[model samples]
Target chain A: MPSAEEAADAVDVTALLERGRTLATPVLKKAVDRLAPPMNTVAAYHFGWIDAAGNPADGDGGKAVRPALAVLSAQAAGAAPEVGVPGAVAVELVHNFSLLHDDLMDGDEQRRHRDTVWKVHGPAQAILVGDALFALGNEVLLEIASVDAGRATRRLTTATRALIDGQAQDISYEHRERVSVEECLEMEGNKTGALLACASSIGAVLGGADDVTADALEKYGYHLGLAFQAVDDLLGIWGDPESTGKQTWSDLRQRKKSLPVVAALAAGGPASERLGELLAADAKNNDFDNFSEAEFAARAALIEEAGGRQWTADEARRQHKIALEALDTVQMPATVRAQFAALADFVVVRKR
Target chain B: MPSAEEAADAVDVTALLERGRTLATPVLKKAVDRLAPPMNTVAAYHFGWIDAAGNPADGDGGKAVRPALAVLSAQAAGAAPEVGVPGAVAVELVHNFSLLHDDLMDGDEQRRHRDTVWKVHGPAQAILVGDALFALGNEVLLEIASVDAGRATRRLTTATRALIDGQAQDISYEHRERVSVEECLEMEGNKTGALLACASSIGAVLGGADDVTADALEKYGYHLGLAFQAVDDLLGIWGDPESTGKQTWSDLRQRKKSLPVVAALAAGGPASERLGELLAADAKNNDFDNFSEAEFAARAALIEEAGGRQWTADEARRQHKIALEALDTVQMPATVRAQFAALADFVVVRKR
Candidate 1:
């Protein structure tokens, strides 16, 4: 039997893949220009362009993961595949918009193998960039509204609000300590799951799915998002950068209040005390000064010793099972369900 | 004889005069849970609550101008008086959103007789607040969408994009040496006019007007925005702080590419050359020894002699006439139109 990871990869089936890029770049292009210059050089670095200093890099960046999820969803929901492209582009743009702001909010120095937008263009420019991307996303939605002109209204607005709600909690959680498992899940639910779910549910809406089907897709994506985040958190602490694009043990060193760390902190004992001390020390040093390799190692030990990592992993598995159940109940073709199911497994279990 | 300025002030009967405070505060509070206490403090400071340091100010600070216009337009459109309160609150929040980011971009130190949000809360937290405000604006729009659903979808999405278009041009012009008068107006239309237009037009939409009526309200507010900005630009250069709450001629000193200055430069000659020198000198001054105070005074004299002020004043009047015509076409109540007309006059003539 094929492994679950391989099954998820089947979601991107060579057979089911649409024939073209097939999305309107012109309508989206004006929104992009209205938001940023074609020649800001730095701002154009994403969506395929030269870098900030006006030099060419390898190529376009970021996986367009959210947008793809959106497009795939529309297709899976049985919409004319081409029709959902605008919404796909829209959801993707919204995702990038969040990334732009989140980087600045987190003071993250790097993204996509280069300096983050704020670091390259200044924070003001970064903020404007995020605003532009957001506006473009809304613009794309309006274009889709023109296409449907009827039901498009409610669906697009709901998705946009869900987008904002997700981000609000993500930023809010940065300085928070003692985040409960449920709270972390809620934060992720809004910050990541909500958008992912919107991507699929909106696709279903575009595809003309009934409310029940749309709701099922939304749940599937929600669970998928939780699993995706859990896997990402795991990578943050333990994965290798050649694959993940980050140095190992970053989450630990940064004292990120991820689900795993939250679990460790909530456990409260020798392991918990040690983890708390490590967090306090990191806070004092800003995870920079006096944070030696030994300290990092010690912190990781405390977290694992407290069973934080295992708890988060188990949580991810539980959510994954729920996602499977949601997909199973969707009344979709078995082939399609298997593809998404496999994809869900891939997202949650990826080593990177 | 009633001067146009006098008539305009009289015409702009403030909307939400009764329900203004009630609508604004509660709406903002509901959108967000103050997850970060320090951020709450930062947002409070932006709202003109406590001084930047967390000490309470005497009382309310902002004039609620934008929200008032929104309410008035709703009423003028023959909607119930209480009907458009949420839209008013939303527009005001968006206005503040831009203000928060603008101060950070400009690196200004003060607002509303106290330190700016970034200065008090630092750049990171201020960024978060601005993002939150922008997000909340969308949420309010989503709330609007729930009622009309279709119109809300098209209107808010379009409005959001228009605002960003305005902002994009505003930022881009900062780097250009010589922007034309037409370009200046286009920029003003987007950066400043669009949101003001949206505020009024949204009210009309909420009031259940047909598209034609809503379109007219938008145009009215658009022209009004031009008039409003012209007056604001004048104050930036010449108004006393006792009135305008900002330094006199700071716009000139900073070489701000406002309509008056752009018009003066486009006219060219010895005056333009001298003004150019002042601008160039200011930029090159990494050290402040580039020019003596007398030299700066001489350039100022050149600009004054070139009639930049008179030219701007004339243009402001021209725009005001267009605004009045648009208002006449809007099919609003005669009394309401008269009130808005008064505000239009005040926009062109207001000292502060």
Candidate 2:
């Protein structure tokens, strides 16, 4: 009976995501169109909606997961999904803004199986268009006539500041030789958790949900966000190339201090010592491309042997359980609660 | 008698700018402090308050012209200058945000006699700190408890979008060979005019001014912004390097499609033809460093012979007149009105 219920929940989650994409795309289009040309063209390409030449393309824009969370959270707070469309659009825009800038800053060449905005259009355009999208996010929130627009704007801006702060710390961490687990979690919470928390609670605020309900939703989103990052960090090293749209051991190749890598280094064993030696050698060369396939595989083996993989998996589950517990603190409709639970399960369990 | 009054107005304008800097510096400092380190450090260095080593530096941060305009505009709307401090800080932040990003985009190494943020730090850090400042601007405005906070946020966001659009156009213009004077003006209006207009009018909105007063102030700002650009364009070509902080014919050396150059190309005379040939030759080599001093002098001569220089001067005066006229449409207090008129006079006639 439990297995049967889980299967139904999976199907429902898929349908909910589809509904979110349908409701959010048109409004997102309108917001992107508000930007002038070149910026508009650059943004369209980044969004996977249009080619560099301004011709439309059939492209996938992620799973619309954040937007779906917003709509579902709003529904859980007693408003229709349509009522959360503005919040969904705002979060989606902010998310893309981060992606555009991050791609440029990281010098990443590809995203969603295509050349990134900076790679195709140049960094200057990427920076400006990212800024435009951010402004548009703010504009979209204010355009909503709800009495909560001011609060929503303030909330979104606060989350955005946290996001920027997180990005700053992430960049700084890369330069440092050592980063503590506590610092990593704090950075993840700011970088990933803040926006997700905002996405989860903004809809409730817009829906005029009571303070208790909104606070509960926020906690749920925060824990879920941390869980999502842990899962993403795991996938970064271990997920299939086809599933993750990245090379195998991509993070390891780049010497990224992801959760598992950091954890393994901190564990201090033979495997940890070997991993540290290998990473230090790579750092000295300052070239990841010099690393051979065997070296990549060996590094992964060391991480796993150091118990990094098990620890990260366990941490993800722990956070996921806490997220669920937070959701239980709220008394939403049973159906809405189930959707939230399903989404949480999807976040932690997905291969990608 | 008129000359005596003009001299008095100049002194008063200087005093007003000093007062604006004094009031806005602490607020700006507080906002910058909100950002975490590395970003906070980069911003502090950019603002001329500190050096790259985190030591204090006695450096000037431009003229604080935008903040002064905000404070004066608030006074014109019957509010105290302190009432407009948030607006002043916000506009100043937005202005610095543009400056930081522009320096990175243009590969400019120097600003106000110091290394640019990107030059001192890196482009990625510059980009992130600029984003942080922009977000801080929005956050500061929303922190105001007055009813106008929402309206102010909306107005500032609108202007920021326009400013970005202008920047996009400006970058696009550099890649194009034949930009008309009309297009250049439009670009300047967006890049330079929009923020100036926002700086000029936001205080009025925050002061709870009537619509008529706000509209007049906006128009005043728009024209003043155009006039400011025109003067800047002139200074770009012919001003003393020591005063302008740039080499003579700096705009031409970079082949920037500034207003005067665009106007000269559109003139279509013998001088225009010669200027076009010279520019085409320069564009082919893509090397400004190879040009001789005689060639630079010749290019400047042709621009003047084509009426570009004279036309720009006349246009500056014309716009200045229009800006002052727009201010006349409002019936603010006599003292505030005199300051506005004085500032207008100072804008067009300043040597640097």
Error of 2 at A219 (Å): 2.0
Q: Which stretches of candidate 1 lie over 4 Å from their true place?
A: A1-43, A53-60, A146-178, A210-212, A268-270, B1-41, B50-61, B146-149, B287-299
> Which prediction has the highest DockQ against the true structure?
2
Per-residue error for B291 in candidate 1, Å, reads 8.7
Q: Going through the candidates in order, what fraction of the true interface contacts does each contain?
A: 0.34, 0.64
List, residue by residue over B1-352, the lDDT tens digit for candidate 1.
Answer: 5654565455424443434555556666555443244556667778876675578776455655566677677787798645666677667767777888778877888776677888877776676677667656655655554444346446655766666666667777877777888988988887778887877777767778778887888888888888888877777776787776665565765667887788777777888777776676666667544555565456556666667777888888988899888887777666677767766765676777
The CA-based lDDT of model 2 is what? 0.86
Candidate 2 pairs with clashing backbones: none
List residue ranges in candidate 2 displaced over 4 A.
A1-11, A145-147, A210-212, B1-11
Cα error, residue B286 of model 2, in Å, equals 4.3
Over A216-335, each residue of candidate 1 has an lDDT whose tens digit, in order, gives 888888888888888778778777877777766877765677888888888878998888876865666753655677777777778888988888898889888888888777776555
